[model samples]
Target: MQPADGINLHSPPPKLKFEKLSAYKKRKLSHSTVNDTSPPTYQISSRAEESDNSSVVEPDKNLMAEYVDFVKVKPTKKEEVLRILNKKDVTSPKFFQLDSITREDMSHWGLNPGIIAQLRDNIKKFEKHLTPQ
Candidate 1:
């Protein structure tokens, strides 16, 4: 029935002594006041307007050309493969033969595995559609 330690049970815990902050310290701790009336001024560069017109316009044209080249290059082989697959009167056997070669070529095409798998699945569906019952 007795407490384990010899310490008194009913006595209040010792009060914590915190030092009072001085006025300077209190001001440092408080949120800083921002001026709301005047709009903030930005330091505009002297070359900003000239750079804006030159840099912006040039990059966009270069980007468009690069983008066009990118578009032309990336999908050209895939488009070729698709066009071959969709050719008139292509038999199932021929399709499977082409698919095997194309699958090998696709590993070199820099395609993701999931996309290659999907393409394989699409080829299978196309072959099924082409085959007479």
Candidate 2:
């Protein structure tokens, strides 16, 4: 006789993953998008900065002259990235060659290009909305 209390004989269930609150919080730092869907966490370092300057730390004992070249201008706005992108229209060939990128790419890091395009098109329209009506 088949017993209802026993495990299923036909197939087994897929393994599941559960995230611990502390571990999940740490993971959140790696990808802030897990909560905030708007805006991004990082962007290009600009020409004034070394390609890998994102995490470079300056020590007090370090000579100013030696690290003079590393001084970088902080990005003030999203328009800056948009401005560079505007230079060529569409995505830049050189930009695609980058070794690393931010949370927000040409296609939301290409997670879903279709949705990214739709949102970008909306942004274009909204910017134009500010024009003379």
Query: Residues 37-115, candidate 1, lDDT per residue (tens digit)?
Result: 4443344344232221222222232332232233343454555434343342222222323423465665565544544
Tell me how far the alpha carbon of residue 107 in candidate 2 is from the true structure, in angstroms, after superposition.
5.1
Relative to the true structure, candidate 2 reaches a TM of 0.18
Best-fitting candidate, scored by lDDT:
1
Cα lDDT of candidate 1 equals 0.41
Write candidate 2's Cα lDDT for 1-133 as tens digits.
Answer: 3545434656433443455678777787657776776655354546313233234333332222111112221335233434444443433222323444322665443324443333333432333443597
Clashing pairs in 1: none
Candidate 2 structure lDDT:
0.38
Measured by TM-score, how close is model 1 to the native structure?
0.22
